[model samples]
Target: MSTQITTDRLVLRPVEASDAARIADLVNDPRVYRMVARIPANQTVAQTLAWIAGHTAGREENTKHPYAIVENGELVGVTSAHRDSTWLPFEIGYWLSPDRWGNGLMTEATEALVGWLKQRGERGFVSGYLDDNPASGRVLEKLAFMKADRIKVFCLGRGEMVGHVNMARID
Candidate 1:
């Protein structure tokens, strides 16, 4: 798969080691951290660096594809696709800074990723939003993903179980 994708207003490129500090600043925001599952609420730059390193290794192994969302030459968010097992469909995930909310940038970024995956012959994907985040659900719906299930998912960032609305798109 290609390492970069661009939309009219944003560039999605592979995450790099140099992005750790910027990404840390974004994810460490309480507003952003509350909605994400994998990033800790009090995440530090060092932890963010480690996370980047792990994702880099995963990319080399073909196990994960994570991109930094850049707009106006600044990193503003992230999007990724990863799987628990090679046989399973990849799960899509994304988040954007609060300042960028309401601009439909995430919807565009996700559509680009989905299009890229389809071009590579991938036919199905799974994604979910925390129950509290209706905006995320709206984004998935805009991409034609159907709600498939509802379940409790443990959010490492929040250190608690939260309800998630699972959605899927299959060709």
Candidate 2:
């Protein structure tokens, strides 16, 4: 089952239909989309709602967790965690709204999520970031995700090749 994690100043829970519009707005922000892979150029509220439904359905079926980050009852970001012992092992991912940038909240929020996931029998989280997003790389380091590998990654949106750092946390 998907889990909910809460911190002193943040709440991390499943994304709901009510969050679709907020999510759409956050995802469409140029700064938020810049460091990631392909993001839809034009996303309607209906499309975001449908996407949330699909994502939640898939999470329910697969036992993964996707969380909407909220502060003061306002959505500010999203995070996801998946376990695949067959191939990729455990992984976590997230994107923060530009408005909340530079707060180090991502690192704090991530540590809370990692501790929560570990309590639920999860460990050895593995994740990476496109090199262009050095902030993400810095977060990995701050969170003690050890360097494991590197590879050239493609960004469909940026239409260029970028490097990525493979990292893992096992404590």
On lDDT, the candidate that comes out on top is 1
The weakest ten consecutive residues by lDDT in model 2 span 81-90
CA displacement after TM-score superposition, residue 138 of candidate 1 (Å) = 0.4
Each model's total of backbone clashes: 0, 0
Clashing pairs in 2: none
lDDT by residue (tens digit), candidate 2, 42-78: 5678987986786776575554677898888888998
Candidate 1 lDDT for residue 41: 83
Name the top TM-score candidate: 1
- Per-residue lDDT of candidate 1, residues 91-157 (tens digit): 9999999999999999999899888777877788999999999999999999999999999988878
10 residues in a row with least lDDT, candidate 1 = 54-63
User: How high is the lDDT of residue 109 in model 1?
Assistant: 91
